[model samples]
Target: MTKVFRLKDLDCANCAAKMEHCLNKIDAINHVSVNFLTQKMVIEADENEFETVMQEVVKVCKKIEPDCKIIM
Candidate 1:
């Protein structure tokens, strides 16, 4: 399954890379792509792990940028 999220406060390339890196660290996340230019993040993972992945994503995103949001 895949999900697209709209993230805020993505003002730099480094922020985008950090978001990608944090999401990639989750074992349930099979893939992650962040478009800094568009302030979007696409995540791919197993259906069974969707909830878990999203939860982790929220936590990671808050850690990286508290102002960011996952546009579920």
Candidate 2:
């Protein structure tokens, strides 16, 4: 399934890029995009494991930018 989430307090475009890269590397993820200009993240992942993948995505985002939040 594909999902779009709003991000809060994303620090910079570089961090957004980093998050996009990390999220795309996940096994269940089919595609990922993090847009600093819009403060949003788009993820397409295995439907059966979507929630699990999203949990990991949140962790990855936190690691990239401690203050960043993906509003579920």
Candidate 3:
């Protein structure tokens, strides 16, 4: 399944790129995008594992940018 989320406090384009890079490394993720300009994120993953993948995504995002939030 595919999902789009709004991001809060995403500081810079570089950070957004970092988030995208990390998220794409996850095995379950098929595609991911982090857009600093729009403050949004898009993720495509297996439907069955999406929730678990998102939990990991949140952790990854937090590690990179503590103040960043992905609105569920």
Candidate 4:
């Protein structure tokens, strides 16, 4: 399944790439697409672990960019 999330404080393509990379590292994630211009992240993962992966995504994103916010 796929989910879309809005991100705050993501001001550049590099930051978006970083966020994508962070999410892609998760074993549960099948794919990730982050667009800084739209401040959105499209995540594909196992349906059963969707919530868990989303929580981890937020955690990892914040770790990479402390000011970033994931709007679920």
Candidate 5:
């Protein structure tokens, strides 16, 4: 399953890159991209585990940028 989410207050390109790298490390996530310029995120994961994968995505993003929000 693939979903696109708007990002709020994503601080920098470096953070976006870090978020992309970390999110892609998840076993359940097939792919992920964080675009700082566009303030958007695209995630691809197993349909059955999409919700759960998003929860992890949020956590990982927060760790990198505390004020950043992934608009569901």
Candidate 6:
């Protein structure tokens, strides 16, 4: 399954890249991308595990940018 999320207050492009890298490392995710210019994130992962994967995604994002939020 694939989904796009709008990010709020994503501080920097480097952080976005880092989050993208971290998310793609997850076994359950097929792929992931973060576009700092647009403050958007795209996630492709197992449909059955999408929710759980997203929870992890949030954690990763939080660790990268505490003020950032994924508009679920």
Rank candidates, TM-score, best first.
3, 5, 6, 2, 4, 1
lDDT of 2 at 19: 88
Task: Please provide TM-scores, in order, for all candidate models, with all chains considered together.
Answer: 0.89, 0.95, 0.97, 0.91, 0.97, 0.95
For candidate 4, write residues 36-72 as lDDT tens digits.
Answer: 8889899999999998888898888888888888877
Off by over 4 Å in 6: none
Q: Please, what are the lDDT tens digits per residue for candidate 5 over residues 12-63?
A: 9999999999999999999998999999999999999999998999999999
Clash-forming residue pairs, model 2: none
lDDT of 3 at 72: 99
Residue 30 C-alpha lDDT in model 1: 95
lDDT score of residue 20 within candidate 5 = 93
lDDT at position 58, candidate 1? 90
lDDT of predicted model 4: 0.87
Q: Taking the tens digit of each residue's C-alpha lDDT, what string does model 3 give over 37-70?
A: 9999999999999999999999999999999999
RMSD of 1: 1.1
The residue-level lDDT of candidate 3 at 11 comes to 93
CA deviation > 4 Å runs, candidate 4? none
What stretches of model 1 exceed 4 Å from their correct place? none
Each prediction's RMSD over C-alphas, in Å, is 1.1, 0.7, 0.5, 1.0, 0.5, 0.7
lDDT of 1 by residue, 1-72 (tens): 988888777777887899899889899999999889989999999999899889998999888878777777
Quick one: ranking by lDDT, best first?
3, 5, 6, 2, 4, 1
**Regarding lDDT, does 1 or 6 come out ahead?**
6
